[model samples]
Target: PLLKIANDMVVDLPTPSNISAWWNFGSLLGLCLVAQILTGLFLAMHYTSDISTAFSSVLIFLHETGSNNPIGLNSNTDKISFHSYFSYKHLVGFAVLLTALTALALFSPNLLGDPDNFTPANPLVTPAHIKP
Candidate 1:
């Protein structure tokens, strides 16, 4: 039924000549969604979504580089700074994901829909529901 509606909608629309790369934005958005899902799954294997262990699990994965210190440096300081690097990388990935989503929406507004979701990340609190 949904496929029929989509086909009818496409038939009702006029096709554009010289379609831009923007036409491919849906695939890009799908790729981003897949990446997010896979990463979330991996994280979930070790993540305790409860309020107590969430932050600690993330810290363990991000901060555990190795035990070897080259110049007798303190492990704690190195881990702290390295964890910041991991955090920055995660933030950048999210930014790219958002950019891809925005581009898709701008080029193809009909493809977008909203579903109720938990609020964005909060280390101190647990979401009341988990979708999957």
Candidate 2:
């Protein structure tokens, strides 16, 4: 019953033709939200009470990296067509984001990191460029 309702609401609903690439952002943002949640979950699982170990674990996760939408209204009311259009846009956005991320991680891993972050941890003294 619920599935039927959802299908009626989303999968078969009609959206306007004016819905542009901008509409794609809702779905893409949703994708980002899910990605962030999963990342937080995994990081929390990997985290530890020990500061040094946690720092190191986070650094490792950073270096290695990790492998890891919306609504409308009526015109002609071709929901599937609009859904397909939005789906394609969503996928293109993901692909572009993924490609850029992969290129940066693979080509310039250190580009975004602070120089001090890669340095060896020293319990005796805090680095001058501490992130906090």
Task: Estimate TM-scores for all models.
Answer: 0.25, 0.30
Which digits, one per residue and each the tens of the lDDT, describe model 1 over residues 90-115? 99999999999899989977665554
Please, what's the RMSD in Å of model 2? Answer: 29.4
| lDDT, model 1 | 0.60
Q: Pick the candidate with the highest lDDT.
A: 2
In candidate 2, what are the lDDT values of residues 51-79, reduced to their tens digit? Answer: 67878889897556542213433444544
lDDT, each prediction: 0.60, 0.63
RMSD of every candidate to native, in Å, equals 25.8, 29.4
Q: Model 1, stretches more than 4 Å misplaced?
A: 1-80, 112-132
